[model samples]
Target: MRRLLLFSGLVGALASCTTASESTTSTKPDRDPVAHSTIVECILYDGMTKTSPQLVTVTAGTEVQITDTVDYYFMKARVVKDGKTYSGYLQRQCFGK
Candidate 1:
């Protein structure tokens, strides 16, 4: 019957569709550890982008706690200055191991 054929086609189509549980898992290379480090030279930005406003000029020898690694060039860092804690994105190259 046409109804039976339609039902089978619908079932076939449903089977061909991806399931909700089926997801793609992207595996990224392990990032180098950079938990705590000192600022050698750089400016801390309010955001991760280059166009973001500069929060502060991190002087050399300033201590920083890396909260997150955004990418190859930037990391979210926290610095304590004058009893105030500032959080922002800093250039990775500005920090020393």
Candidate 2:
């Protein structure tokens, strides 16, 4: 009876260890993909002035393909202009590249 109890205890310990290891190895997906279509030049419009238009020259189009799809806490867009690439977070209202 003592030997049987010892064997049962050992088996329980091994099962608990296996369960802990499996839980630790699990990973959660958080990053999400940004949807972008055609690239186009976007100008920032001034809200105060109604007559004259203030145009910010964006050399590169906005459309960019997402290399990976994951839920990123922040949405980032890469803009290429004047042979240089610039990366920045997308404004809340901006969409469709």
Candidate 3:
């Protein structure tokens, strides 16, 4: 029957059209255990990143490790006082050149 043929054709067509999939996993490299690392001083930061709930402020000349520079204004750094790495945005230039 024509209906049976059409159904078979449709099934065949759908079977021929296979979907290929590719998987990828992204992992950030470790930039810690810095040796001879250049420390940066916090010049100005409005308590912390606006997104963070806890407001943390660092005084001038605070020792910090600039890990990943997200952009010209913000960078991922570790505050030496807390001993925990945090991603915070900096409002003013605070690092020593």
lDDT of 2 at 74: 27
Candidate 3 Cα errors over 4 Å, as ranges: 1-30, 33-54, 82-87
Worst 10 residues of 2 by lDDT: 43-52
User: Judged by lDDT, which candidate is best?
Assistant: 1
Question: Ten-residue segment with the worst summed lDDT in candidate 1?
Answer: 30-39
Whole-model lDDT per candidate: 0.79, 0.48, 0.53
Q: What is candidate 3's lDDT per residue for 1-95, written digit by digit as tens?
A: 99999999998877666532232444657666331232343432323454545435666656566655666666565554466545445543555
**Against the hidden true structure, what lDDT does model 3 obtain?**
0.53
- Model 3, C-alpha of 72: deviation from truth (Å): 1.1
Model 2 root-mean-square deviation:
8.7
lDDT of 3 at 13: 78
Query: Which 10 consecutive residues of model 3 have the lowest summed lDDT?
Result: 35-44
Per-residue lDDT of 1-97 in model 1, one digit per residue for the tens?
A: 9999999999887876755336566466655434565557678899888799988887888778787888988998887778888889998888665
Candidate 1 TM-score to native: 0.58
lDDT of 2 by residue, 1-97 (tens): 9999999999999999998888855587655545464344543323222232533334344564333322332234454556775444433233442
Best-matching candidate per TM-score: 1
TM values, all candidates: 0.58, 0.34, 0.39
For every candidate, C-alpha RMSD to the true structure in Å: 5.1, 8.7, 7.0
